[model samples]
Structures are given as structure tokens and as C-alpha cells.
Target: MKKANKLLKEIVVLIFALLFLSPIYIVFANSFKDRGELYESVLALPSSYSFQYYLQAMERMNFISAFGNSLVVTAVSIFFLVILSSMTAWMLARTNNKLSKIIFMSFIATMLIPFQTIMMPLIQFMDQIMRLTNIPMLNTHGGLIFMHIGFNSALSIFLYHGFITTIPKSLEEAATIDGCSKFMLFWKIVLPMLKPITVTVIILNVIQIWNDFLLPSLVLTSPGLRTIPLTTFYFFGQFTIQWNLAMAGLTLTLIPIVIFYLFAQKHIIKGIGEGAIK
Candidate 1:
């Protein structure tokens, strides 16, 4: 009976796996075919496998530049996000005051608000600031970074705050008793202890900011500043779809993210597990 049940479970798992993978199979198969072949049979293997679509996408999207821009923006955003959020969360969790409570609650509240509702106002404020300060907040990488910092910081802080509360106050107290300064206490004791949550925050924000389209599109208007998603969009024309090339571009866009996750998969799982342990 146990053997039969195990076989049945295996069959179920295989079926569900195939169901989810069918679309990806179609994308891969169709990407090798020409436009006519794709229209005729989306799922059929190509009559002749060629890397033409990938080559075309690479040239058209200026692959190297797009890859570089994405790397720079994502790295900067993640750097600031991890630092600001982790530190803010540590402070908020350690301190007990009306101000800290209100600030923490405000971060949670901001997360509940939809981005679309604030899009126009955000753009206006940014425009005004640019005009007043001559900082060129619109149509620039810096603008995108600023927006990412604002939008992503609240979420990161919330995650950090939740995980920080699970840490023992005795750790900080012990550090203080040893004549450690407040900054030293955090850098030496708390930051090391918060490694799991920091990893969790990095993984989460990397996925969010890397794949995000709307905000980047709004802020980064120049073709030179285009990230992966925006670069993919250029493959679409007013009337033409270029499905094969589009799929190739999509594949290129997903590869970095996929590689990052594969390498960091263990840390990601451990971080999430530890973060939730409390």
C-alpha cells in the first residue's frame, strides 16, 4: 500500500510539473523558428535550429550596454536598500517610543498603498525637485535610483523590523557593557546577528528592482539608460511583434536573474527559514 501511494504521488508531481513547463517549452521551441513557422506551429520544433534571433536581439538591444545599465542600477539600489533598511529596522526595533512606533507603522501603511495611485504625484514632486535643485531627476539613472530607494526602502524596513524583533536585546546590552559605542554595537554585534534577515532582504529586493518595469520606464527615458525590460520593449514596434526575437530578448533578460538565484539558492532558503524561525 505504501509503495502504491508513493507511485501515485510521483505521477501527480510529474503531471503538475509538465503542466507548468509547457509554456516555457513552447517559448523555447518557437524562439528558434522564423515568423512564418511560429505562426503555423507555436509548439513545433524548428525545421532548422539557428541562433539568428538571438543575434538579432543582441545587436538590436545593444546587449552589453543594457546589461551594464541594469547591473549598475540594481547594484546601487540594493546597496542602499540593504544598508538603510537594516539600520532603520534595528533602531526601530531597539527603541521603544511613540515616534518609533509611528514611524514603523507608517512604513507598513505605505506598503498597503498601490503604486499607481501615487505615480502621478510622485512624478510631479520629482519634476519639481529637479526644476528647483537642477538635479535632473527625470530621464536619468539617478532619478530611477531615487525612486527605487523611496519605494523599496519601506518594504525592506518592514522585513528588517520584523526579523530584528526576534533578536535578543541581551546581545546589544552585552555589547554595551563591554564599552562598545552605539555604532560599534550595531556593526559588531547586531549586524552580524542580522545576517539571515539581511540575506532575505537582498534576495527579495534584487528580484523586485531587477524585474520592475513601470517605475524604470517612467524615470529612464533615454535609450542609453534602458534596463533589460525597457530594452525588451524596444523589440516591439507599432504594428510588428517579432515574437522570435522578443522571446530571445526575454531569455536574455531572465538569464542573469536565474543565474543569481541558482548560486544564492541555499542562502536564500536559509535566510527565509531563519527569518521566520521566531
Candidate 2:
């Protein structure tokens, strides 16, 4: 009976996996097809595979510019997030004061609140604050980066704090004995040891920032500055949706992330496992 149940569970899992992946399968299959072939057989392989649609998508989406923008935003935001959140987490983990504990709990509580709840207010504050202080936090790439830092910092800090707690203070004490300054100790010793959590933070933020639609859409008004997701929306209209082009665009958008995951997935898994072991 146990063996039968195990077999049944495997079958169920396989079915669900296929169910989730069917859309991706269809997208890839259709991407190589012309309009007529796509219309005729959305599920079937292309009569003869072609790259014309890929070329067309590249031209229409200004793939280079969009890709560059995404790269810049994702990289910059991740850099700031790692630096700021890791430092904050290290402090929170090391300090036993009541204020630090309270602050940490508040950050955890903030995570429970969905972005949608405060999104409108956030925009208003950015605009108003930028206007008042000349800080330029609206409808700009820099502005978007600032917003991402604020939104993502809490979660990054939480992850880093958890991982850092498991690290022994002996390392820091030894570094101090070697005449290491506080900054030097953190940069050289603590940060290197925090690699597992750093990888976790990078992977999570990359996926989130790369695929984020609402935040970018709300913050960036210029067509030239559109990220891949926002740019992909051009293929759809109120009356007609260009399914072929849209699918092609989506396929293009997924390529970088898929490639990233393929390469870094090892690191991601290793990091999570190491952190979990701690």
C-alpha cells in the first residue's frame, strides 16, 4: 500500500508539472511559427522553424535598449540592497538591545503588508518629497532604484540577519585582534562569510526586479526607459492582441532570466542549502 501510494504521488506530481509547463511549451513551439502556422496549430511544431519573428521582436522592442535598462536597474538596485541590508542585518543580529529587537520585529511586520496597500501613498510621497526637497524620486530610473531599495531592504535584512546569527563571533574577534577597523572587519571577514545569504538575496531580487511590472510601470513614464515587461505590453491593444509577436516578445524576455537561472541555479541551491545547514 505504501509503494502504491508513493507511485500515485509521483504520478500526481508529474501531471501538475506538465500542467504548469504547458504554456511555456506552447510559447516555444509557436515562436518559431508564422502567423498562419500559429493560427492553424498552436500546439504543433513549426512547419519549418524560422528566426524572422525573433528578429522582428528585436527591432520592435528595441531589445538592446530595454535589455540595457533592465541590466542597469537590476544591478544597481541589487548592489545597494546587498550593501545596505547586509550591514543592517549584521548590526541587528549582533546587537542585543531592545531597540534593535523592536526594529527587527517592525521590519518583519512591514513584510506582511502587501505593496498594493501602500503603493499609491508611496508614489505620492516620492512626488511630493521630491518636489519639496529637490530629490528627484519620480518618473526616473534613479527614482525607481530608490523605491526598490526601500521596498526590498526589509526582506534582504531579514534573510541576512538570520544567516549572520549562525556565524560565530570568534571570527570578528580574531579580525579585531589583527587591528582590523570596523568597516574592514565587516568588508573582509563578515561579508565573505555571508556569501550564502548574499546569493539568496541576489537571486530573489533579480527575479523580482527583472519581472516587476507594476512598480516600473508606475514610476517610469517614458517609453524610451521602459523595461522589458513594460515594453512587451506594446504588442497588445484594446481591440487586437498580437499573439505571435507577444509570445515572441515574452520568449525574448524570458531568455536572460532562464539563462541566468541555468548558470546560477547551482549557486542558488548551494547557498540555500548552506544557509539552511547553519
Candidate 3:
């Protein structure tokens, strides 16, 4: 009876998984179909698969440039987030002072506030800073990346803090006794030990920053600086509700992140599992 129940649960989960993935399957299938076939039947398999829509999407969206922009933004943002958040979290976790506790709590508090509430104010603030300093804060990749770091750092810091607390401080003491400086100790010992959580942080931030649309839309005005999501949106608009081309564009946009997730999925799962246990 237990085995039967387990089997039944597995079947149920499999059903739900397929149900969740059906939309993606539809998009992938329809991406290959022309407008005529898509209009006739979205659910049906394409009579003949063609890459014409993909080609059209690539050309219309300027996929290469958009992909490069997203890559640069996401890569730079994640790099800084990992370094800064990890160090901040480690300091907060190791220092058991009231101020550290309060600061860590503040970071956690910010996570409760919805991004939508601050979206307008954030844009305005950036604009004001740009006006005051005559700095290029809007319509620039650096500005977008900076915003991503600010918005995403809270969660990353929280995750790193939790993971850091689980690590033994005796190791740091041992390293100190051996004459290792704080900087060298953290770089050689603490940071390397944070591999699992770091992987999790990277995967999470990569997906969030790469697929971000609203933030990028608000920050990046230049057509040349658009990310994949923004480019895909403009492509959809230009195509005027052409579902085939739209789906093709979306499919192309999804390919890179999907590949990244596939590569890092094992580490993500492992990190989360260990974090939960810790």
C-alpha cells in the first residue's frame, strides 16, 4: 500500500509537471509553424517545421546585439552581487553586535517591500542623480546593472548570511593563528567554502536580471542598448500580433537562460537542499 501510494503520488506530480510545461511545448511547436498553421490550430503539430520565423525574429530583433547587452549586464551585476553580498553577509554573520543584527534585519525588511511600490520613485531618484551629477544613469547598461544590484542584493545577502552562519568560525581563528590576514583568510578560506551558496546566488540572479523586462524598459531608452526581453517586446510590437514570430522571438530569448539553468541546475538543487538542512 505504501509503495502504491508513492507510485500514485509520482504519477500525480508527473501530470502536474506536464500541465505546467504544456504552454512552453505549445510555444516551441508554434514557433516552427507559419501564421496560417498557427491560426488554424495552435495545438496541432506543425505540418512542416521551418526556421523562417526564427530567422525573421533574429533579423527584426537584432538578436545578437540584444543578447550581448543582456550578457554584459547580467554578468557584471552577478559578479558584483556575489562579491559584495558574500562579504557583507559574512561580516554580518560573524559579528554578533547589535548594529550588525539590526543591519541584517534591515536587509531582510527590504525584502518584504514590493518592488512595484518603489518603481516610480526609483526611476525618479536615478533621474535626479543623473541631473545633479551630470552622469549617464538612464539609457545605459551600467545604470541598468547598478539598479539590478541594488534591487537583487537584499535576497542574495540574506541567502549568503544564512549560509555563512552555518560555517564554523573556528576555521577563521585557526587561519588567524597561522598569520593569515583577514583579506587572505576570507579569499582563500571563507569564500571558497561558499561555493554551493554562491552557485545558487548566481543562478537566481542570472535568471532574474537576464529576463527582467520592466526595469530594463524603464532604464534603457536607446534601441542599441536593449536587452533580450526589451528587444523581444519591440519585435512583438513591430510584428503586430504575429503569434508565430512572437513565439519565435520568445523562444530565442529563452534559449540562453534555459541552457544556463540546465548547466547549473544540479548545483542549484544541491545548494537549496543543503541550505534547507543547515
Candidate 4:
């Protein structure tokens, strides 16, 4: 009976796994086919594999510039997000006071507010700031990254805060007695111990910032500043949609983050498990 139950559970899991992966199979399979072939049998495999559509999609998408924009935005945003949020979380975790609690709560509250509700006002406010100060807040990669950090900090801080609070205060106290400076205490002692949660924080934000579309769409007006998703949008026309090219574009867009997530995925699991264990 135990063996039969285990086998039944495996079968159920396999079913769900196949269901989850079906869209990926469809997209990748359809990407290699031409329009006529795609329309003829959407689910059927192509007669021959071809790189022609991929090359065309890359050309039309200005793949290099768009890819670079995405890399910069994601990398830069995550860099600051990790550093700033970790530090903020550490401080909040260490400081047992009403002010710190209030600040931490503020971060949590921001996460509760839906982005759709604030998006219009956010755009208007940024535009006004740009006009008033001429600091180029609305349309540049810098502005976009700044916004990413602001939007993402709460989760990063929340993760870091929970993990930090679990750490014994004795460690920081010992470091202080050892004549370690405040800066050194974090850099040399605390930050190193935060490796697990840090990796988790990084993977989560990388996924979020990399795939985000709406915020970037609102901020980036210049063609050169378009990210992968924005470039992929050109394949969709009101009248004439290029199914093959769109699929190829999607595959390209998915490749980097997919590879990244695959490699970093284990770390997320390990981190969570460790946090739970602690």
C-alpha cells in the first residue's frame, strides 16, 4: 500500500510538471517554424530546424542594445538593492526601538500598496522632478534603476531583517569588544554570515527586475533605452503579427534569465532551508 501510494503521488507530480512545461515546449517548437508551417499545424514539429527566424528577430529587435539595456538595468538595480537593503535591514534588526520598528513597518506597508494604483502618479511625479531639476529622472536608465531599487527594497530588507534577527547579538557584541569598527563589524563579520540570505535576496530581485515590463515601459521612451521585453513588443502588430519572430524573441529574452535562475535556483532553496533551520 505504501509503495502504491508513493507511485500515485509521483504520477500526479509528473502530470503537473508536464502541464507546466507544455507552453515552453510550444514556444520553442513554434519558434523554429515559418508562418505557413506554424499556421498549418501549431503543435506539429517543423520539417526542418532553422536559424533564419532567430537571426531576423535579433536584427529587427536591435538585440545587442536591448540586451545591454536589460543587463545594465537588472545588474545595477540588484547591486544597489542588495547593498542598501542589507545594510538597512541590519540596522533595523539591531536597533530595538520604536523608530526602527516604524521604519521597517513603512517598508512593509509600501509592499502592500499595488503598483497599478501608484503608477500614474509615479510617472507624473518623476516627470515633474525632471522638469524642475533637469536631473533627467524620467527617461534614463539611471532613473529606471533608481525606481527599481525603491520598489524592490522592501522585500530585500524584509528577507534580510528576518535572517539578521535570527543571528545572536553576541556576535556583534564580541566583534565590538575585539576593537572592530562599526563598518568592519558589518563588512568583516555580519555581511559574510549573510551569504545564504544574500544569495536568496539577489535571485529574487534579479528575477523580478529582469522580467518587469510595465515600469520600464513607462520610464523608457527612447528607442535605444528599450529592454528585451520592449524590443520583443515590435513583433506584435495590430494587424500582422509575426508569430515565428515573436516566439524567437521570447526565447532569446528567456535565455539569459532562465540560465541565471537555473544556476542560482539551488541557492534559493538552500538559503530558505537554512533560514528555516535557524
Candidate 5:
């Protein structure tokens, strides 16, 4: 009876999984079909698969440039976020002072505030800073990356703080007794031990920053600086929508992140499991 119940549960979960994935499947299938076939039957298999829409979308969207811009922004933002958040969390974890506790709590508190509430004010502040300093904060990759770091740091710091607390302080003490400096101790001893949580942080931030649309849309105005999501808007127009082209563009945009997740999924799962245990 127990085995039967487990099997039945698995079957139910599988059904739900398929249901969740149906929209993605529909988009992928329709991407290969022409407009008429897509409109006629979205769920049906394409009568003949063709890459024409993909080719057209790629050309119209300037996929290569947009892809490069996204890669640069995501990579730079995650790099700084991981380094800064990890160090900040490590400090918070090791220090038991009231100030540290208050600061850590402050980071956690920011996570409760919705991004939508601050979106307009954030943009205005950036614009004001740009005007005051004569800096190109808007319509620039650096500006977008800076915003990503600010927005993503709270969660990253929280995750790192939780994981760092689980680590033994004796490890740092031992390193110190051997004459290792604080920086070296952290770099050689503590950071390596933080692999599991670090992987989780990287994967989470990568996906968030890479697929972000609204933030990028508000920050990036130049056509040359558009990300994949912004570039996909080319398929949309006032009078008519290029559904087939839009689908193809979406498929292309999804492929990179899907491939990245597939490659890193094992590490991600392992990190989460280990972090949970710790």
C-alpha cells in the first residue's frame, strides 16, 4: 500500500509538471511553424519544421549585439555581487556585535520591500545623479549592472550569512595562529568552504539578471545596449504582432539560460541540499 501510494504521488506530480511545461512546449513548437499554422493550431506539431522565423528574428533583433550586452552586464553584476555580498555576510557572521546584528537585519528588512514601490524613485534618483555628476548612468551597461548589484545584493547577503554561520570559527582561529592574514584566511580557508552556497548565489543571480526585462527597459535606452528581452520587442508593433517571429525570438532568448541551467543544475541542487543540512 505504501509503495502504491508513492507511485500514485509520483504520477500526480508528473502530470502537474507537464501541465506547467505546456506553455513552453507550445512556444517552442509554434516557433518552428509559420504564422498560419501557428494560428490554426498552436498545440499541434508543425507539419514541416522551418528555421526561417528564427533567422528573420535573429536579423531583426540583432541578436548577437544584444546577447553580448546581456552577457557583459550579467557577468559584471554577478561578479561584484558575489564578492561584496560574501565578504559582507562573512563579516556579519563572524562579528557578534549589536551593530553587526542590526546591519544584517537591515539587509533582511530591505528584502521585504517590493521593487515596484521604488522603481520610479530609483530611476529618478539615477537620473538626478547623472545630471549632477555629468555621468552616463542612464542608457549604459555599467549603470544597469550597478542597479542589478544593488537590487540583488540583499538576497545574496542573506543566503551567504545563513551559510557562513554554519561554518566553524575555529577554522579561522587556526589559520590566524599560523600567521595567515584576515584576507588570506578568508580567501584560502573560508571562501573555499563556501563553495556550496556560492554556487547557489551565482546560479540564482545569473538567472535573475539575465532574464530581467523591466529594469533593463527602464535603464537602457540605446538600441546598441539592449538585452535579449528588450531586443525581442522588435517583433511587437502597434497595428500587428509577429506572433511567429516573437515565439522564435523567445525561443532563442531562452536557449542560453536553459543551457546554462542544464550545465549547472547538479551543482545548484547539491548546493541547496548541502546548505540545508548545514
Candidate 6:
């Protein structure tokens, strides 16, 4: 009876896994096909695997430029988010006072507010700042990075705050006794110990910023500044969608983050688990 139950559970789990993976399979399999093949058999595996479509899409989309734009935005945003949030969380954790608590709570509270509600106002605010300072906020990569940092900071700080509190003050005390400055102590001792949660924060932000299309669409209007997701729009038009090239382009787009996530995925779980428990 127990064996039969176990077998049934396995079957059910396998069914769900297959259902989840079906879309990926379809996209990956169709990427090598042409329009006729895609139309004739959407689910059928390709007769021949070829890189021609990918090469064509890459040439048309200016894949290198689009890729560089995305890399710059995502990397720069994550860099600031990690450094600033880590420092902020450490300070908040170390300061034992009501004001610190209030500030920390404020960061947490901001996470509750949906971005959609304030997006219009945020754009207006950026425009106002741009007009005032003559800084290019709209139609620029800098603007998109600025927004990514703002939107992702709350969660990164939350994660860091939780994990920072778990760190023993004794370490900092010993470092201080050895003639370490506050900045050096954090850089040398505290930051090194934050590897687990740092990895978690990176994974989260990478996925968020890399995949985000709406905010980029709003902030960046120049064709030259288009990120990977924005470039995917080229494959789409008023009438017809180029499924073959679209699928290939999407496959290329997915490769970087997918490879990144697959490699660092275990760290994500590790970080979250450690942060939660300790």
C-alpha cells in the first residue's frame, strides 16, 4: 500500500514538472525552425538544428549593442544596490534606537507600495529633476539604472538587515581593537561574512532588473539604448510576428541569465535559508 502511494505521488509530481517545463521545451525546440516549420508543427522537434536564425536575429537586432546596454544597466544597478543597501542595513542593525527602527521600518514599508501606482508620478518627478538640473533622466541608460536601484533597494536592504543582525558584534569589536576604522571594518570583516545573503540579493536583483521591460520602456525611448527585452520588440510589429526569429532571439536573451541563475541558484537558497534561520 505504501509503495503504491509513493508511486502515485511520483507520477503526480512528474506531471506537474512536465507541465511547467513544456513552454521552455516549445520555445527552445522551435528556435531552430523556420516560419513554415513553426506553423506546421509548433510542438514538433526540428528536423535540423541550425544557428542561422540566431545569427540573422543577432545581426538585425544589433545583439552586441543591445546586450551591452542590458549588461551596463543590470551590473551598475546591482553594484549600487548591493553596496549602498549593505552599508545601510549594517548601520541600521548596529544602531540600537527608535529612530533606527523607524528608518528600517520605512524601508520595509516602501516595499508594500506597488510600483504601478507611483510610476507616472515618478516619471514626472524625474522629468522635473532633469529640467531643474539639466541631467538626462529620460531616454537614457542612467535613468533606467537609477530607477532599478530605487525599486530594488528595499528588498536588498531587508535581506541584508536580517542577515547583518545575525553577525556577532564581537567580530567588529575585535577589529576595532586592532585599530580598524568603521569603513575598513565593514569592508574587511563584515562584508566578507555577508557572502551568503549577498549572493541571494544579487540573484534576486539580477532576475528582476534583467527581465524588467515596463520601466525600461518608459525611461528609455532611444532605439540605440534598447536592452535585450526592448530589442525583442523589433521582432514584433503591427501585423505579423516573426516567430522563428523571435524564438531564437528570446533563446539568446534567456541564455545569459539562465546560465547565471543555474550556476548561482544554490547560493540563492543557501542565502535565504541562512538569513531566515540566523
Global lDDT scores for all candidate models: 0.84, 0.85, 0.89, 0.87, 0.87, 0.87
Question: Per-residue lDDT for 12-51 in model 3, tens only?
Answer: 9999999999988899999988777888998998898889
- List model 6 lDDT by residue over 1-278, tens digit each: 99999999999999999989899889899989888888898899999999998998788787899999999999999999999999999999999999999999998999889889989999999999999999999988888898899899989989999888877899899989999999999999989998878888888888789888889988988889999888877545421467787778778888887788688778867765764564
lDDT per residue as tens, model 5, 153-187? 98889889988887779989988999999899889
lDDT, candidate 5, at 131: 96
Decide which is better by TM-score, 3 or 6.
3
**TM-score against truth, every candidate:** 0.91, 0.88, 0.89, 0.90, 0.88, 0.88
Sort order, lDDT high to low: 3, 6, 5, 4, 2, 1
RMSD of 4: 2.8
Candidate 6 segments whose C-alpha is farther than 4 A from its true place: 1-16, 271-278
Cα deviation at 145, candidate 5, in Å, is 0.9
Pairs clashing in candidate 1? none
Per lDDT, the best of the predicted structures is 3
lDDT pick, better of 2 and 3: 3
Return the TM-score for candidate 6, rounded to 2 decimals. Answer: 0.88
Worst 10 residues of 2 by lDDT: 233-242
Stretches of model 3 off by over 4 angstroms after superposition: 1-16, 272-278
lDDT of 1 by residue, 1-278 (tens): 99999999999999999989788777778778888888898877889988988888888988889889988998999998888888898999988999999999998888889889999998999999988999999998878987898899887887788878876798789879989999998888888887877888888778788888899888888899999878777656521567788777767776787798799989877766654553
Clashing pairs for predicted structure model 6, backbone only: none
Question: Worst lDDT window (10 residues) for model 6?
Answer: 233-242
Q: Stretches of candidate 5 above 4 Å error?
A: 1-16, 237-240, 269-278
Q: Of models 1 and 6, which has the larger lDDT?
A: 6
lDDT of 3 at 47: 94
- Alpha-carbon deviation at 160 in model 6, angstroms: 0.8
